[model samples]
Target: MEQIWDNNDWLESANHWVTKQLKLQKINSIGRLKPVSGWGLGHVLKQPTEQGDVYFKATAKLPLFSNEALLSRYLHSINMPTPEVLAIEETHQYQLTKDFGGGLAEDSSATLWADAFEQFAQLQLDSLSYLKDFNKQGCLNRPISDVAAQLQLLIEHPQLQSLLDSEIILATEKAIAKLSHNIDELSQLEIGETLVHGDLHIENVAMSDDQCIFFDWSDACISHPFIDGTYLYRMPDSQDKTQIIDAYLKPWKQHYQPQQVEQAWQLCEHVCYAHQAISYASMMLHLSPEARVELNTAFQNALSASLRSNRQTVKSTTCVRSKFCGMVSGILHTLSLIQIKAGEAL
Candidate 1:
C-alpha cells in the first residue's frame, strides 16, 4: 500500500491544485511546496505564498475522523475561532488554511491554561444549540445511549479480539456491563449533550489576543462536553489539574452544582476511556499491518484504563470537592509544548 506522500503522481497533482487555489486567491507561490509531516494517519504540507505560509492537510478517510475542512468551516460559521480556510477539496480530504502562528508554549502560565479551559467550556456549552447541524455535517454521534452497543460490537469484532488477551477481554466485557449501569445513572442527570473536542489539549489551541483559535477538528464529535475535560486534564506537564478542571467546569456552574457536576464526571470517567478504545478500533480497520502493530499498545491501554476505572468506587462529594478547587489561579509550569510548524494542523 502506497502512502499518499509516497505517490509521485498524487504529489504532482496536489502541488498543481494548491498552486491553482493560491492563484485564484491572487496569491503567488514564492517557494516550493514543503512536506512538514506525513504518517499513516494524515499528511501536512506547507506552501509559501506571497502572503505567508498556507497549509495543506489531508486526513485519512476514517469512520471517526470527520471531513475536517467542512467541519472547521461550519464551526467558524457558528462563531468558533477556527483557522481561516482558503480552499478545500472534499473528494481528496484536502484543506488549505492560513497560518495562525504557534500554539501555547511549554512555559505558558497557568492563568492562560485556565482562561483557555473556561473559554472552550463556554464554546462547548454554546454548541448545544447546533447539535442538529453538527450531526448533519458528519460529526460522529456517539451518545451515552449508543456506547454499550458500540462496545459490544467491538468486543465481537474478530480484529479486536485477535489483539486482546483472554483476561483483558473478560475484564472489558465485565467493564462494559458496568458501564451500561453507570450510563443509566448519568442519563438521569439530564445533562445536555454538546460538542466534544475528542482530542483536546494545549497543542490544538492558538491564542490571538483574547480569542482562542482552536484547530484540528478531525476528532471532534457531538457528545457530552465532560469527555473533553478528561483529555484536557491529562495534558502533559501538569502536576495538579484541579484548577484546570475547575476552570473547565466554571461555565457549567449555572446549570449544575459542584456536587452534581462531580458526580456526572465520575460516572463518565470510564466512558471516555471506552470511547478511546472504540475510536482506536475504528482506526484499526484503516491502518496497514505495520501501522496496526504500532497502534496495538495504545488500543490495549485504553481498554485497560476503562476496566481499571470500573473497579474503583466513586469518591465522596467531600473528597471530590477537596480534590477540586472552585477558583482558577495563576501559576507557571514547563509543559512539553509542540511547536506549531507551518500550520500545525496535525
Candidate 2:
C-alpha cells in the first residue's frame, strides 16, 4: 500500500509497457491523476490534445491480463460502449493500458443510468454466443455460494453479527436459499449457449451522451443469456424498470427463448446480491472508523430493501379482499413486482 512508486515514476514505467502493445508517445506531466478504486493496481491520466482529450490508465500485472484485453477488444468491435485500448503491454514491473477511460465510479447516479443499462442489454444480445466460451455459467456462479460462507465467517465479528438479529440474518439466509434454488432453475431452463457479463453493475457501466460503455472485463465470461441484467434487476422503481427491460426483451425474445431470458434475471439478482456481500466484506474488513460507519449503513440499507421485498413477495402470493387490507396488499404486491418488471419470475 505504500505509494506504488511515485505517480510520475509509475507513469513512465507504465508507458514502456504500453509501447510494447501499441504505438504511443510518452507525454510530460499527466493531465490529472484520477482517483479510482477496485483492483487497486490501475490509475487514470488525462492528456489534453489539440484534436480532443485523451486518457490513459496504468496497471501493475493484471490477473488474466491478456484475457481482459481480448474481451475488451471483442466488446469494442461490437460497438458496445468501452474504452479503446489504444495499446497494452508489460514493462519492468508493471503492465499498462493506453487511453483507458469509462466505467462508473463509487459516486454516480443510478436513476440517470438508463442509457448505460440499455447499452448493456443490447450488448448482451450481441455478445451472448461468445460469452460462454470465456467462462462457464455454473462455475462463474459458485461465487454466490462463497458469499454465504463469507457472511458465516462474520459470526465472530460482533459488529457484523449484531446485524443478523431481528430477522436480518434469517431473512438473508432465506433469500440466499432462494437464490440457490433459482440458480438451479436456470440450469434447468433449457436455455442454450450464450455469453454473460458475470459481474455487471452500475459501477461497472458508464455513460457518455447516447453511448454506454462497460469496462472491467476481469469477470467477463460465458454465461446463460440473461445473467447480465444483475444490476438493473436490483435497481429502484418498477415503472421505469419495466419499460427498460421491455426495451431489451420484448423484441429480442422472438429470437431466443423468453423464459430463458426471464431465468437469467432471477439468477443474476441473487448472484449480484452475493457479490455485493463479498464486496462489502472486502471493504469493511479493514475500514477506518468513518468508512466502517458508512459501510454498515450501506449494508443495513441493502438488508432493509431485501426484507421489504420478501414480505411483499409473500403478500403477492396471498389473496386480497378488503379495501384496507387490499391497500397494504397492493403496496406489497407492487414491491414484489420488481422481479416481474426486471424480467425475473414470481
Candidate 3:
C-alpha cells in the first residue's frame, strides 16, 4: 500500500499550502520540497527558504500521533525549548517548523549529556502544571495505575498472541500480579506524573545555541517522569551514565527524599519496559497488517523484556547489578531463552 505522502494529489496540496504559508512569513522558497524520510506512520519534507530551511511533517491520522503539532506548540508556549512552529494545521496533523540545526551528535561529550539530562529533568518537572493543556491536546494519558490493565489487554490481544509462543503468553499473564504490586508500591511514593517523551533518545534532541532543544513530540505523553529514563539506563558508559543519572535525579530531589527517589527509579526499571511494550502494541493497533509486521519484533521484544525485568526484580529486593538487563542487548539474550521454553505452557 502506498503511503499518504506518496499520493501526488496530497503532495501537491501540501506543497501549495506550504508555499502560501512561507509567503505569509515573508520567506521565499528557494527550492522545491525534498523528501527526507517517510513511512506508513508519517513523512518529513525539507523546504529550503531564503531565511533558512524549514521542515514539514505530517503524521498518520491516529489519536496517538495527531497531537504532535499542537502539543509541540503548547510545550514552546510553556517555555520548553522546542523548535519554533512556523504554522500548524491541527486538523490534518500537519506542522511546519524552522530547522533547529543537527541533533545531538553521536560523539557528544559527557558534559553535554549531563546538561541535556538536567534540562530535560526540569522540563518534566515543570510540565506538571500543564497537565490540563496536555490532555486537551490529546496526549496519551498512561498513568502508572492503569498499566496493569494495559498488560492484561495485551495478554488477550489475539494478533499479538498469535505471534508469541504459549510460554511467552503465559509469562506475560503471570507478570501481571507481581507488576501490579510494584506499581502500587511505586505509586505510594508519589513521584508525580509529568510529560514523557515516549520515544526519547539523544537523536530526538537538538543542540541549539548550547541549549538542549527537544522536538519530535509524536510520542509525547503524560506519565511517571522516570519512565523517560529508558535510554539513560542503556548508555554504554558507566561513569558518564552515573553523571547523567545524577543530573536527572538532582531536580527531583527537591520534592522527595533520596531514598524515595532511588526506590522509585529502581521500580520504574520494569514498569518502563512495560510502558514500551504497551506503546508499541498500541501503535500496532493503528497500523495495517503489512505495517504491523514491521513492528512485531519490537512489540514482542518489549513485552519479553517487561516480563523478564519483573522476574528479575522479584528475585532480588536490592537494585539489580546490571542496569542494562531487560534492555535491547538483554532482549537478544532473552530471545534465546524464549525459544528454549516455547514448547512449554503454563
Q: Which candidate's lDDT is highest? A: 3
Candidate 1 lDDT at 131 equals 85
- The collision pairs in model 1 are none
Number of clashing residue pairs in every model? 0, 7, 0
Q: Give the TM-score (vs. native) of candidate 1.
A: 0.85
lDDT of 3 by residue, 1-346 (tens): 3345656788887888889999998999987888998776788899999988999998776545537888887777778888988898887678899998857875788788788888998889888888887888758787888888988997798977887889988888888898999899889989999999887777788987778899887878888998888777556658988998898899898878776787788788788888888878877887778778888898888887788778767654454334434354688878988977885743
User: Candidates' lDDT values, in order?
Assistant: 0.78, 0.51, 0.81
Ranking by TM-score: 3, 1, 2
RMSD of each predicted structure: 13.0, 10.0, 12.3
Per-residue lDDT over 190-304 for candidate 1, one digit per residue giving the tens place of the 0 to 100 score:
7889998887777788988788888888888888777776565334546446677778888787777766787777777777888888888888867778778878898898888
Worst 10 residues of 2 by lDDT: 136-145
Error of 3 at 203 (Å): 0.4
Candidate 3 lands at a TM-score of 0.87
Clashing pairs in 2: 55-99, 81-213, 128-195, 131-195, 131-222, 132-222, 135-222
Worst 10 residues of 3 by lDDT: 317-326
- Per the 3 Å backbone cut-off, how many clashing residue pairs does candidate 1 have? 0
